[model samples]
Target: MLYPNGWFAVCLSSSLKPGRLRTVAFMGNELLVYRTRSGRVRVIEPHCPHLGAHFGYGGKVDGENLVCPFHGLVFGPNGVCIGAGRSRTPPRAKLDEWLVQERAGAVLVWRHNKGKAPDWEVPDSNMAGFSAAQEACFELKGYSYYGPENTADATHFMQVHHLTDVAMSHEIRQHQMEVNLTASWFGWQIKVRMINYGVGCAYAESELPAWGLFMKSYSFGTPIAPLKWTYTLLDSTHVRWLDALPRVLRWPPQALVGALMHWLTVKEIRKDFRIWNHRRHVNDPKLMQGEMHIAAFRRWMMQFYLRD
Candidate 1:
């Protein structure tokens, strides 16, 4: 499948501090990500238009501009070259800037095969409770579309995760899909509400009212190469009464609870990773009656892909 065009996370917001630069690979392209002294984040093609030097390796942030290490060339956040050592700015001397958004403690960049502007924006980071402390990344051999599409595959809850009494319903909107799932996990009833915005980003919020536990998780997948992609998962957990308890007494137990929840979520994804890593894409899937949404999801996903 062609890479889906949308906003896809590249790294955690915490990873890039002010006046810092980092290199990241996304959608089969190398990008230089940096934060200006003013605290604005920028994503641009890594190669310097002056002499083809990779800026990500030794790029320096000068106030709000990026300076190339190779020849001291400077470029602004808009990617236009200002000058190099009092020299005149050359025509067409600029880097390609990508549309970037920092949300939910993650850095997301918009990607279009033909450089088209993003049609929709990522959801507000404040919509759910997410913390940078609880996050994990995994490298997997699979298409970038698999993770978000799997969220609507209702049958997988019982077959893959071993959850019982599984029930799921979904509604598709202009730029997002909402899925609600109710199931029994180890005798505890859990309800999960997930919203997939395009194929690159999805957020799932899970609640266990009986246990006073609440979790918000975000999943992002970006293509690194053909049949290869990187998947990142981040989640934050809160215990109901713990928040009201005395700080001194609640610290240890709350930490333990959050850690356990994070571990369990990772374990569940690892199980799915195994299946996705080795499976082949079946264009004409022999799905059962209950698997109608799987086909519908595929049709929706195709809209994000560019045609020749």
Candidate 2:
């Protein structure tokens, strides 16, 4: 069973077609999804409870409700039985309502025994920052724990892709600050100034949380157990390199920075993608104890995975 106690991405927002149903597996169960005539989204048991017929392949939306193709049974978005087969006997009040929400241009469904929604809000990223944002899906030939662990494994940032001057090298010694607790914040800012091994030095803050490795990230897995990831690059170096470099370059201002930054970032990302593709579900010395980001990110992950 997938998403045993959390939300999982099922499909991109563009996959849902009006009046057409799609069967998806979540929380170890099959859910039938379809858009109503009024464009409302609905989820229900994939098989018709009356006779075990697949609902997704032949289902239709009637007004704001979803109707079974086999028996013409109708269900509301709340999973209430609004009507069945033209019978006015008042539908049963015992239907189950599934939890579904949209985040990062994708539609997610939560399957749980408690049937509750998450209180945390997904960050609203400035989608226009990237020079290009393309959606493509790839398979992970391994287990989820490995994928989660990769987010904190920074040593590879340099070794695997030959990326130098990453965030890991900006170590702050004798800079002791206690971890702060917060109830919640729809937005946040992080500030840090340090002498680093990168091109000169800079100060930056981002809305995305620093989780071991990935800040702004997205991933999903099916109940059948394969996982996939679609990474979006924000502000590529080719797009902002020269401005990012601490000192003015010796060449044309825009020409040097934009072209150089984008080229380097794209080259590094392609290398990382190749490394990521070959790593299925292997456990390695990806991280060690006392690593700065792992513990914090694990806690954050738990908050999302275990929240009622």
Candidate 3:
């Protein structure tokens, strides 16, 4: 199984400024991701269509076009070679384009075997009400589909995340999964609700009613190559009482909680990296009755891959 056919995040939206270009590794190949002068992100094949120079090396963004390093050929947002050096007129060449979109402050590219068009769209959340995302990225030694399966495994949370008195339930809808849970952590009763979108992305919200604190987190896992992937997490917190406080005092507490949430979340997820980095997936797993959801999740994931 190579990288499965689905949407995988390529990079952070904030990383690509206007007229910035980057060489990104995605789905076992190299892609050129660039933002135009007007701030539109485009993902394309990394080579100059005419001479075959990799754009990641010396590629430059000219206004709304991407300039080739070799012959200064220009490619527009549609990946068409619209400008060639000198007065020879643009050649009948075009760079290949990939389906990409920005959501929750990250760029997601839809990938499929044999270049098939995407069948579904990723759902959006209400991020406008939250603060700016506190982010972290990790280069993991393991592959993905592993990240999403964790939602169904409860025993590991107790051993890995150190949970106490946890109850969880799930609602599945084809490519999407909603998980709601109530847990007791260090005497605080917390409620968490998460939406897992395909194998690549997850959006989660944590609520502390007594403290009037709400936290949101977006997680993405992107495959860089075989048996390796990149994991990114962005977290933000909103304190309900902040709005009642003075303007000067409103944001500080919220920002402080956001920062702390980011730190603690990152710390907890790092514990799983130790296991995920070294674990292997077995086609036929030995499962207990309590782990039935893990098996169901694996069955659900098969739809994301191309079939024979």
Candidate 4:
């Protein structure tokens, strides 16, 4: 499968520390990921431009430059070699840098097979008052399309999550899509809104006003290998009572509620993991009524994974 041209996450932002270097597997290849002493995140091909030495093997960061172990070549944040070991003038060498952004507590790398610049940006999703992200990642034997398609699937809620009276609406434009769903889960009214920034990342918010419960979730579909990928979900919960508690006494309750929410959300999401991994695409199947959005979603995704 062709990796879609979009901003895909490689790792969580909190996982990388300043002046630290490491390797990450993305789009079926290993890429070097590091943070500078000044707290800048950079992603580049692991191999050094000189002698094809792997940066992840013995690379170190000095201030804002990456020092290669093979030749002691120092590369600036822009990936240009400025100093060479035991030499006055550095040889002509440069490391190719990948476009990267840190947002919503994740490190995202932009990919365009045709070498085009990123025309769209990932929306900042950090919540100021919400609890810290509770994250989990799982391997999927599927393409990135499944995540967005699943968001547009309305009938599945009744069958899978045991919801009733489900209705969905969509607003799509260019590289963004929003889906709103209203339903009843065992007599409690609930509403969910999903905003997808392309097909790789999506934000979901749920409201249960009657129950005084709300939740926020962000999911990233990252390609790793042919017919193989990873699905990561970051969830946070906002309990109404937690807000009323004193600042000094809120941490424990907030942490407890957030953990419970994360567990429930993960358990519910696991129900779809089996279907996503084992399911096959139906190019032209006769979809049931109220499934037009699924077809539209399939059409909307074509722009991201076009044929060369």
User: Evaluated with lDDT, which candidate comes out highest?
Assistant: 4
lDDT of 2: 0.46
Total clashing pairs for each candidate = 0, 7, 0, 0
lDDT of 3 by residue, 211-271 (tens): 8889988899999988889999988888888878886777777788888878888889999
| TM-score for each of the candidates | 0.93, 0.60, 0.96, 0.96
Model 1 ranges with Cα > 4 A deviation: 86-92, 125-133, 247-252
Question: 231 in model 2: Cα distance from truth in Å?
Answer: 8.6
Q: Residue 120 CA error for candidate 4 (Å)? A: 1.1
lDDT per residue as tens, model 4, 12-54: 8888999878797788898899999989999999999889999
Model 4 stretches with alpha carbons more than 4 Å out: none
For each candidate in turn, give its C-alpha RMSD to the true structure in angstroms: 2.1, 10.6, 1.4, 1.5
Reference-based lDDT, residue 103, model 4? 74
Candidates' C-alpha lDDT = 0.84, 0.46, 0.84, 0.87
Q: Candidate 1: give the clashing pairs.
A: none
Model 3 steric clash pairs: none
What pairs collide in candidate 4? Answer: none
Q: Across residues 55-155, which tens digit of lDDT does each residue of candidate 1 receive?
A: 87777999999998888888876888877865755546878888899887789998778878877987764533222247788889979888988888988
**Cα lDDT for residue 13, model 4?**
83
**Residue 30 deviation, candidate 4, in Å?**
1.9
**Of models 1 and 3, which has the larger TM-score?**
3
Backbone clash total for model 4 is: 0
